[model samples]
Target: MTLCLSLLFLFTIQPSHSITTTTAYAADNSLQRVKARGKIVMATSPDYPPYEFQVSKNGKSEVVGMDVDIMKQVAKDLGVKLVVKSMSFSNVLVAVETGKADVAMSGINPTPERRQSVDFSEIYYNGGQSFLINKTDAGKYTSKASLAHKIIGAQTGTLQYNLAKSKIPGAQVKGMDKNTDLVLALKTHKIDALGIETPSAEAYVKNDPDLKMIKSGYSLNKNDTGSAMALKKGSGTLVAAINKSITKIKAKGLPNQYLAQAGKYMKVNTHNTSMFHYWTYFAKGIEYTLLISAISVIFGVLLGTILALMRFSKSKIFHAISIAYVEFVRGTPLMVQVMFVYFGIGIVVNLPALLSGIIAVSLNSGAYVEEIIRGGINSVDKGQTEASASLGLAKTDTMRFVVLPQALKNIWPALGNEFVSLVKESSIVSIIGVTDLIYQLNIVRADTYRGVMPVFVAMIIYFVMTFILTRVLNYFEGRMKHAK
Candidate 1:
């Protein structure tokens, strides 16, 4: 099985290599495409404050920050509207690289490694480097030197993460995708300190009384500290236009103004930090979560039934294809599949985040459902099929009416279990910015600056959702047994 799977992976990767070769020969029309579309989509992770973060204004949630303000001005200069795409910080650059967004700007620092994949604009704002430590440990870990031989946390794929690994002697660096998660880790003593940019550290310190910020005191160039906008490689036209706008903004000191505005929004967010205050955020989260799961379930079952039928077919080609697809999907992680569907397949077809998430999840669930269905069908006695044939019934009718009814009854519990798992697994879509329960939970955590309470609320909500679904499934299962 491992050897077969290895061959399958090689076959799958072959097409992507060809796709890259084709992309290399494609013309660089990044600016022309955006202008023709009349809107430039900018991808960002909105959990970072004063750079890019979510805020409630006039009862509507919107992404806003200095990065957003800078992008807005860039859009204006180019005579186009700015569209914001929010996702995990790690996906921001991927969005631009895959044509999901025209650019990415989330207080991103241009490092040597990142420049290889994406083009960056001129340095915008240098927030410097700092470590977020517990207030109680203030006396023990005072500066960069004190953090030596300590466990340090930093966001993965950021300058801070690299610094934590290279600068600190014997430092066990724990890298996470989101800063809020790292903050929670620090509060729980999972790590001694969190390396972060100075402005973000200050924001966290101001909002949370238990946290304190200390300078990293490491030697760094402007590229290591300065924020910049990342575009797809070969976006010279767009990059030049963005740099021109940035130069003007810097000359007029607009970034300071934008930062001031973001501070006010942050103040509004912190004024009412209660979980109940952000019920709408959770409600919206529940809406999207249920939407993704419900659609995926329906499509998954349909796909599963087809695949199961294909497996039962006498044709070798049909059976081999079904086997390959089922094995491939079940072998890989759902997170990687979601990203592949969104960013990988997206190179050919521009799929929205929600649609990509639903497609990936349905494809994943279909493989498992196919197995459950196959087992259930096998459990049905062969005598039943012979009996149906004896009654002069067609093969299709016999299987659909007699075999399927019994199989469904046998697999009902297993199906229910898969559905329950789907609800939890759907949270993975949040990484692609689907705004499901987990995504909203992160937004609330970032907005309110209260991490634990929002997490607790989301946990209860998920439990309630899955519990209700379990009862409904039980009711149907009971009715099926009553018919017996």
Candidate 2:
């Protein structure tokens, strides 16, 4: 009875303390605290052309756009220095919610689900969504009826994607992760059309002569409602300050000035031309990716073989150390490990990005190869070791002459599979900016405003490489068996 009463008392106190902590945290996240910090971190997606993009002019970063210019005004009004951080659109929301950034202003539209986590400032710019199609198919897509049974692409979780699904009920919609992906899908003939925003589609098609928009008599499910900046929930003070700044910018025509300047680089009108012409710029990216993967695999195999020997060595210290290495490498995620080795180690080692990629991938591959080699070695018969011993051979001689030859024959197939996995795994090195196949794909998507062809090309190249490796390994294995 005493224990039950104690438990009840503890439960009763928990809710009150929790509420007190929540209220205190809410009070702490005020405009005064933000101003005192003297810096406002703004999250944006650099992949969106004419809104936010990364460019180097005379070896300096210049992020120029209507969105950037407006955010700068807001920061000045708040008496805080502006710091822009580039990330994916999805990650922008995460940054705002986590308080990693003061606000997210990369063409964000207020949605119901988003409101649950963060508050949005009043609309800043009015923008409507539209569809871009190949010039040859522009006439055929005059109405919803003409678009029936055709494959259409749109970025995932966007207003355009939702509208396309509801309005074009008969159209097959393929969701992508970015606007560039939608453009690429249309360009490659992977999809007949792409549902995109009007400004973004216009910006993409300016350089392409093969893509066009069907602007005549299309339905607007939602108005090109103005976009707004997102803040953490209940940041009324910050929201009010941003709104006041936006009002001033509108009155001074500063927004228009910024838009006009941005227009110089982007197309302001819809035309029929290929928007994916920039894909040709990423050929060098493909070469870099292949080089990294090939070198990593070669070095990885050599290191793995050495580690495998260590694990099987008679010395207790070598065996223990090898076991620890295998466990450590296999236990961690490849992406985290790659970042740690590249970014973390680069701070101290000052190695080139390509060398860091090779070292990271090789270390990871070596751990798995150790297991594969150990398994192959054990699969060899004990009789071979005993026969070598009877011939007055030393333990090392027995392994080198008798055991390893048979083990290699048995392990050739597994080794080939490991090589294939290593090739695919090399894609992760791109996160540290190693310009692998996926990195090239991203570059092509950004430049051409297209996403499918580069990915398709990458997939084909990986398949061809794996196929050839398999054939070569199989031929070697066959020769080994015939010799025996």
Total backbone clashes of model 1? Answer: 0
- Report the lDDT tens digits of candidate 1 across residue range 106-223: 9899999888777799998988889999999999999898999999999998999899999999999999999999999999999999999888999999999999999999999987
Which candidate number would show the highest TM-score if scored against the true structure? 1
Question: Candidate 1 — which pairs collide?
Answer: none
Give each model's whole-structure lDDT. 0.91, 0.71
TM-score for each of the candidates: 0.95, 0.63
Report the error of model 2 at residue 262, Å. 1.9
Q: Model 2: per-residue lDDT, tens digit, 260-332?
A: 7776634421121133443333454557766776787788788888999999888999999889889988998
